[model samples]
Target: MADIFSPSRLGGTSQAVALASACLSILLVLYLMFFADLYRRPDATESQVAQTLEGRPPLDIHIEMMSLDPIRQTVEARLNFPERRADAAQAGGARVRLSDGGFVRELHLPADRAAGATSVEFGLDGSISAYPFDVYRTDALIAAFAGEGAQEAPLAVQLTVWERLPAWEARVVSRPARPGEVGLPISIEARRPPAHVVFALIVYAVMAVIAVCGLAIGVLAACGVRKIEAAFASSLAGMLFAAPMLRNAMPGAPPLGVAADAYVFLWVQVALMIGLVLFICAWARRGSPP
Candidate 1:
């Protein structure tokens, strides 16, 4: 019974194996380091554009922003406009309207309307309802106010929130607040990363074996060593099954459940890979045909 895990029993090829393993390990690590750039986050302003609107003049306004919640699928906003009176000498008053081009949009108007400033909300449903990673929703509110003479029509504000529905869900909340405090609630979420560390051990073991064996076989072949042909064939077959495992291994790796916990997991991976390579090399050496 050959104990494949015994390191000392591996044939008298430790020197050659060590040299080959070190070179192979460095090369594979370097390849991964180069490819890591593709997975990095882009550098740019955190605030992203959402919507654009154009309207008439005379509407001087200020906006106050609030918090946004994507899990609940809702956005709360407030709009403040110049005051206006409908009945006065120069027949005037401010008129406000809300509009959206059916971009999965929903609006929640203030339950209570008043003369000075008003609050409104918009909700989106479906896919667009959810917040996107690296992008924030932008709602365009257009306020058009015009009046002539003594009693200028009161400048009233209309809270119009427009968004695409189905692709997302939108909710609007309104509350009374002092003047100079009104804004649109914007929600931003990050896209999830792919590797999951929890199931990574299996992958590490598999890759170590493949990479180490490949190195062993390659070295033997380059030196015109005939006996290594069988080991080379096995190494090639093992590597094919290991590639996909590495791709999925990191994304699903469990997140650091607590602070500093990731360090423990990382060290474990390092140790496991080292142990696996040494064990595989020893076993392969011992198994070499007489």
Candidate 2:
């Protein structure tokens, strides 16, 4: 490793390091973002099939997010109703949660079947606050209806579920119009990640580039001077600029006094790792005698 760090080997080593760094960063980001089913159970049924309520339906139903922490016996959710009307008309109102018995049931159901049957309490029964599915229109009498007393708000009434531990993804399977077939139709789809994912990725990429460039430039500026201490200080300062990003990537680290988009935390790590490499290269350039 020392030999690889030598100026004589810097060119090849730098390229190799950069490439390895990029790949590792990408893999790390993907592992964090897509690999661990931390938020949802792996192989859990993601799609649901209901008897086709076909009519070019004005709205669509979807599960937004489901989190289960059994020790706490807690579940969190956000369901989606993709379309709503200018009027109070919307789609859906309830969902069923399935238990180990494979019986469909309401969320947070009571221990007594009769009580739960009457109240249907499995997790929060109604729509999640702060992310209501209703779309408020802003024209004429329609807009006026939204002035505080709209009762027919939009909601999602269906749910797709599977065992929490099974390695099987659930889909809403339905009986075919024919006499004996049952299967999920190709038209059914799981909920798509919101547009925010794309937006966050782009923003993070751009920020990473800027941070990397700043780190490289900081090192380069310090190299102009012959003082080793000054150059080291400059490099340290560069890394400090990236400290917030690093803290987020590290598990259990507190937020580093910076507000960041939670979704971009993965890419922020990639950028910081890349920036570290460029700084190392710049420091190598400075170490050479005039």
C-alpha lDDT of all candidate models, in order:
0.39, 0.37
TM-score against native, each model: 0.27, 0.28
Local accuracy of candidate 1 as per-residue lDDT tens digits, 34-91:
5584367343221222222233223333333344434443444555543432221122
| Alpha carbon deviation, residue 51, candidate 2 (Å) | 5.1
Off by over 4 Å in 2: 1-193, 222-290
Per-residue lDDT of 172-268 in model 2, one digit per residue for the tens? 2332343332212211112213232334344456666655655555455445533333365465455546645544443222333323434444455
What residue runs in model 1 are displaced by over 4 Å at the alpha carbon?
1-58, 69-72, 82-93, 101-117, 128-141, 147-290
Instruction: Please report the TM-score between candidate 1 and the true structure.
Output: 0.27
Each candidate structure's count of clashing pairs: 54, 8
Clashing pairs in 2: 45-170, 49-172, 107-121, 107-122, 107-123, 108-121, 108-122, 108-123
